[model samples]
Target: MSTDLSLFGVVNAGSSSLKFAIYEAESCLLSGQVEGIGVRPGSKARDAAGQPIPAPDVTRQPPATPAEALLMLLPWLRDRLGGRTVSALGHRVVHGGPQHARPERVTPALLEQLTVFESLAPLHQPHNLAPIRAVLERMPQLPQVACFDTAFHRSMPEVAQAFALPYAMTERGLRRYGFHGLSYEYIAGRLPELAPDIAAGRVIVAHLGNGASLCALQGGRSVATTMGFSALEGLPMGTRCGELDPAVVLFLLERGMSPAEIQDLLYRRSGMLGLSGLSSDFRDLLASPEPRARFALEVFVYRVARSVGSLAAALGGLDGLVFTAGVGENAAPVRAAVCEACRWLGVELDSEANAVHGPRISRPGSRAAAYVLPTDENLMIARHTRALVAT
Candidate 1:
């Protein structure tokens, strides 16, 4: 019916959930997720306005994996297309290794290459790839693209990627590879439109969600980022330990702990969850009366502030600080605390603006400007997918 309309589909699959969105040009038409994939699969969807919409009937037999969940999602997405051509599907792949500096069309060879990176991103890579495989199997005609989270940081200088390890190991791909490139890429692209002055100068963007990381962008390109080699490298996150000395792993091993046990402790049992011995959701932690919750919040804020300072140094100086993602955009208290800690960097928060979740939250007199710009990783994926498909 609408021959002029073409839609782009985006999939961001995690360890146990599948999030999806449909886009007509740049506007998101419908978005939602199928969560609790293995144990108790359930789906919920909403239109662009966030109003409830009838979700696809996925309960005939609960999906046992991300791929199965995706299989169920495809038909529903097709119905919503309403005669419009679905150009391509874009995936949020966690790692792209040393090569693949840009969005790539999914192919057998590309899938093989991406599979190798699973060891580098155990908690994420497998799930991120499952849906792509499902699309390949179930809808072979559809063109799919893999938009990597590590792709944007490929612009960083070699010195920033080095780990001081032996040259041999570095040559063998032991260097840093930043994650959350989709979000950072979106923020970088947006900055020029929102604040052209800072966009051309030095800026640090804090993508503070469940998987938190900071990126130093100079002239809208990544110069340095907090996460290196793995998503577990930087910023204490929802359930992952942020930065730790390598000797700690040796100590754990000498104590008879296996590598798997160490991985579990560091990846799924640490961070705000372990620190608070409570919940990992920042909203929950912020509201709790428990001292551990308060302590956990304090640690998160402190690390973010300290990391912002670190990234600022990488940029040579601070021109702008951007807060994006979940905790960055929604949590006013966290933003205020981080701004207070960065007072030395000339970030003076406008209390009223911060409380209201500002697009710009800094005082006019502050040397460095601070902003709360919500990230749209899904849209970024769609744009890339559409471009690749058109080409």
Candidate 2:
């Protein structure tokens, strides 16, 4: 019989932090985060019931790099297991490029292939692999699996994936690859239960966090998405300048900006931060009384509403809309504004329901139903890991 693995580890490595959770047969036994990596790093954890557990060692004790952080977290995890064995480690790889359409067992070859997509997702790809390598060295016998953020959208039709570039350029692998697939996958899986009435129709899942994107789902499959080619190409994020005209890069280059400078500018200096010239945190902007903060929020809402229109077109119609992730789930004002902008699309937001961040916030007569749903990408990763390792 296949090994009925009981423990699974899920790691989501971002540019600045790693969020990890330990699961025993699908129940989260422990969850925590190591934040400020490469800066003033720190770690904190909690039990499945949400009780505060001690940090790996103490607050700010985690390493300042992905490799070091993974090494540190491994020992802590082993200690917490109390003799329980971790059957495998599952990773949330932000990019799978064109080849990886599903979870793949981590190998030297797989890691190498994933590295090739690093430049395509400069912010996430490298960090995602660091832990995989660290685990390989720390416990070579342990299995590792990688679940891709781009995998779920691999089912997108050719027309949705194509970039309208020359066939030669397209063959060279420059094309749209929708991101946040794992989050969308989780939301899609739950939509039937959360909003059964509209789950079968065309739905748009807006994952609005520090990183934001909209996935157009028809009958539970991706028909189109706002993010294409890279995470930097969709809605304005915490620092990313989304959906820039190609000529904008040319303009910057002609102005004597180097490629590296352009990369930093678009990926770090733009978005709400650039617009406000103040802060990137939506909470900060909302708390501020400054007009610039209001402008930044306006720009964000405007673009989100605009993307919804485009994605709706891709699906040929709209039935329901979902808001998820950080800003989508917590920022009631932002949701209200986006719903306000989309009023023309027949979205009638229930002011009271939106305020509480409930699962459903739409009016009965609304042509488009609006919902606030939480995403669980780690759960998705753990599920994939257990299935893969069982084989």
Candidate 3:
């Protein structure tokens, strides 16, 4: 666990991809992912300087299962490590339920307990745990850590985490549990260095991408967030419907739509894709002149701006607003529109700064500052693993 010689490996396994990074203490040496794991499989990587790390011929062997995918990834990772050894492995687990409030060491009992959460996050939980199990089988003594995406939001007040459901249902775990916690946690940790004035004040971070959410950070801790119960709530994402009325499900059922069909409609076929009738990619929609595409973009900005107000209200007021993730960090137009819509909150857009993707985009003296800070969940997981394993 000596920082001088030990390397830490971080894994973020998604439904269709496996992202990995190597860190020497606090510095990342390499990072990459294997995309389209089961279909049209391909892999790519880069070093700390952003130089492409060439893939070996063995990576061309497409993995048929999650275990197979890990098998393909490990050898490539080993060859890239030069001569150093990875002291411990950290994984990004999407849901930690109510009990796991922080990162914990990976164990068979923990894996079995985490499996019970798959029903709550059918698209992610299983995939996130697969590689951990595979590694445990292959290297039983290699210390592994499981970091929760819901762990950061455990700081939210009781009322914010509650639902209006019956007391019995509430007791049965039917309540709000925010997601994208790892990303938010990273942003929160960086605020002191990046925006010291408001680091301990009320701030709202918009994590926009194909899957989006807004988090309200008060004094560097989560007080509320847009995503609740599941990632499908809050902001309108690339393909997922952000917020919906439960009655709509009953209405669809009355019309003969099965629960499965409705679930697919809300989680996949809706959002910007359903609105634009074009694509789930913001880059694609931004370039298209189609009316539906423009409308989709409009809806996305409107929801994000509205959510900022809601989170601000939760914090009693707003001191700063931050944009992160794919759409938030790169899409200048989206940031422009969102900031403009949130002018009531005292955000003044600096077109020049935004166009260049600023670490700070709001004009000086604005009542509430705005920024575009990139998120690094992998680094956050690595730091947690290093700390836990070192001890």
Candidate 4:
């Protein structure tokens, strides 16, 4: 039932925010909108062009969930688009549980299978499915797709995906399932057009935002990544304590903390927000003079640099470095520190160009080139949605 109404939507359900984008076939016709819904409510909705729209009167209540947010979003989208028929809805499901390596149309059976992996990605998977469920209930006729963040990294070598635990645990899905695949996939897709030389070489793509990770891409495929098992395993993020010693979990448990409490602490109350005792926003930390905030920022940069080194090893060597997402694309100081740490690998930063963000920030004589490319996960999801629904 193909029609000119090739417009589709990509929903990225975050813990506090619900992002939705409308696309015209392949190209993104608009920017998208996000509604921040939670107990700590400060609600504002924006249209695709990023213009602020008056938010519906969603109250500051605990039950003000993502499903509620999605319900609110459908009308907003429909009003703005003048009732364009949504051909499909694509979701950025965080964990595909080793089995889903490609995008799939949402089904009751598929949703059930996806729910089983929620424990593996407690912070993201459950929320990811909320929109799918909402769409199923309210707009049952429209096709929906689930494009996994971990799916693209499925190409990583077996050695890169394993944990040092028991073989039984490995078989039970206890291994690296890298997040931020849609972001990296978008960057990889644009690399050939933006930087053809680096696109074909050993490259490391850093997706740094509120949630951060680095992926080593060889010829546009993931060879290694910093995130593993879950997004919580990567570099310290806005509120996530990444790569904590497993013993720390036992220690907390021994101190009488239940699994649920510990999970909340690690996934919600930790990372830069926990360390700084201030805001999770990097801009906040960067502007603060508090020692804790400085320390938190330093730790974030250190972890990113350290991960870059490890990923370079996985690639045998490094040809170029690409930074995207919010912090990677905007924060000058963070990029400077990371590139400085990677100087030994022949990354010579252009101080002026770095301050003024560029597609190429490395100096002419540098052995390894550096670039700043903004990521578009929505576009990637929309493309996948179109391809799957068309089939």
Candidate 5:
């Protein structure tokens, strides 16, 4: 097919940033992001080897919206391309409702329908669509695909997805819909080669980043996950308050807390930032000697351990655990603390291996294995796009 080309571009838009990657088939050619979108001084680019590529022009022109930021990023990317054609664009959308449980081509009708899902994922869905819309307007002829964050979890059994709510509400689509699907999917695909022994059994992948979640896989298929209904329902994130009691919302409402104010408090003011009042960055928290930082870390570890236990029950037993994402892959102390808490479940951490970022952190005698697997959601998205668009 003359239309087919090897190049594919992936865009992952979040509330505060836009990350884009260009891939020559499965290999990443280059990637970049404009963090602090509404804020300033956040444009950064890098080549395949992670070497910084300066973008002075992007720094000079500030983008007021995520859509504008991606549009601004186009020319610089094009210049870098020299003359290569991008076969298709792949986007990471957080919520897909039940109607879209797989990667779907982006259409005007689909985009309109996705808007109704925005209220379900207030902070992420809109931003996820911004770059897609920008690309649509700039390159109307370009083929694009949306790889949903909730799609992979659709494989979960009814028992795993069901809530205690009435049948009517549950049938109306108010049920657990796990996120970080792309990340978990990538891990599932790679787990067999990475850990052949544990790949065929019960395992958990902790995607701990600014936005975090735990996913349980039984033989490389999603059986359960920590996130439910929305991205805010799982583990404590960089700024989002996770797993809050339902009564708390009523109490706040009764006390005259405006919905907007409450949203701001949970989605922007909470997490390690709220607990420490110092910093949300795990590196900053670890470097600081402040008791507040220590307490915040303790809370995060406690929640992760608890979630691991819950997921283990879902699996009926545990064979291994794999940590991925920003914090999971890098923060040694965080991983150590969580693993120590899970000692009863058979995790013996090799402190030396962990400190140096070893893939296998568990001692051979440990019952449940532990490993650090770096996740590549962009690569996952590109794979899905290529499969769907057939380039």
Candidate 6:
């Protein structure tokens, strides 16, 4: 007989931070902590609600490595969980390449397979793999699962996933594979509970965080998404340049810059931080008087609005718009700008309602409903982990 596991742990390890959550069966039992493992200089911790949190006592230096961060967080999690034993662990892996479409139990072979896709998601994959390796060393017997961010977008049409590359290159895995799948999955799961009418129709979810992307959902499945091939293809983010001309990359290479240097410039030195030269945080940019900050904000909004229109077209019509993640849940101005840009698509933003943070932020008579639904990707991971283990 299979043992019934009751608790599961989910971890999302980013380039600089680790976000964790614990679930009892399929329900989230507690919101987890964010441990700044390898944060850049001048970064600060914020509560899950986006309020500032006191930083843990650590030497003031460059960000701690992912392993060091996980070492610190494990103890904290143990204390908060009161010695609770999670039967399984789920990880949010950023790239699954062409093969993975669902959660899989982590093994040496699987890890080796995943390593091949590391170049496809250089900024996140290594960091994501670090904690899993650490946990494996610590708990040799514990079952671990990997849930890919690209998995949910697997249902995207062939035309949407492909580029006009040669068959040989395409076969080698050059194609769109959207990120933020767990977040989109969680939102899709909650739709029946939140808005049955819209959930049954066409839906677009905007996952706006340090890394942002939009997904088009029809009948509760992904039809298309903004991020293509790499996370760097969609919306401009905290540090990454979203989309650029192929010729730009060639030009940079021709300037004697190595591929690694070009990658760093595109992934770490661009986006809001590069454009603003002040801050990557939307709140910080909003507070700044610099014209560059204003320009960055405009660029972000413009890309988001443009993507919304494109995704809507992919869905044929827009039924609902879901705003999620960090900025999507809290940044009123960003949402306002996006809604204004989408006004032609029947979005009517309720200013006062939006300011107050409504799950339903659209006017009653608006043709397309707008909402602010907080996403819990970790919870989704935990659920998938539990299900896979139970079977």
lDDT of each: 0.91, 0.90, 0.89, 0.87, 0.89, 0.84
Q: Which should have the higher TM-score, number 5 or number 6?
A: 5
Q: Across residues 1-391, which tens digit of lDDT does each residue of candidate 6 receive?
A: 2223687778878776666666776566555444545554232344445555554344454436665665565555555556766788899899988899998999878888998888888988998888888878887688999999999989998888999989788788888888899999999999999877699888999999889999999998998999999889989999999989999999999999999999999999999999999888999998889999999999999999999999999988898898999999999999999999999999999999999878899999899999999987877888789889988
lDDT of 3 by residue, 252-339 (tens): 9999999889878988899999999999999999999999999999999999999999999999998999999999999999999999
Which is better, 1 or 4, measured by lDDT?
Answer: 1
lDDT of 5 by residue, 1-391 (tens): 2333888889988777888999987899899888887777478889989899885355677787778887887667777887566788899999998788999999988999888889778888999997888888888899999999999999999988889999899889999999999999999999889988799999999999988999999999999999998888878888888999989988999999999998888888999899999987888998999999999999999999999999999999989999999999999999999999999899999999999877999988899999999999999999999889983
TM-score of each: 0.97, 0.97, 0.96, 0.94, 0.96, 0.90
TM-score of 5: 0.96
Model 4 worst lDDT window (10 residues): 54-63
Candidate 4: residue pairs that collide: 31-48, 32-48
Every candidate's CA RMSD: 1.6, 2.0, 1.9, 2.3, 1.8, 3.6
**By TM-score, is 3 or 4 better?**
3
Best candidate (score: lDDT): 1
**Distance (Å) between predicted and true CA of 72, model 2?**
1.3
As for candidate 3, its clashing pairs are: none
- lDDT of model number 1: 0.91
The CA-based lDDT of model 6 is what?
0.84
TM-score of 3: 0.96
lDDT (tens digit, per residue) of candidate 1 on 255-354:
9999999999999999999999999899999999999999999999999999998888888899899999999999999999999999999899999999
What's the count of clashing pairs in each model shown? 0, 1, 0, 2, 0, 1
CA deviation > 4 Å runs, candidate 6: 1-4, 26-31, 34-64, 68-83
- Model 2 lDDT vs. the true structure? 0.90
User: lDDT-based ranking, best first?
Assistant: 1, 2, 5, 3, 4, 6
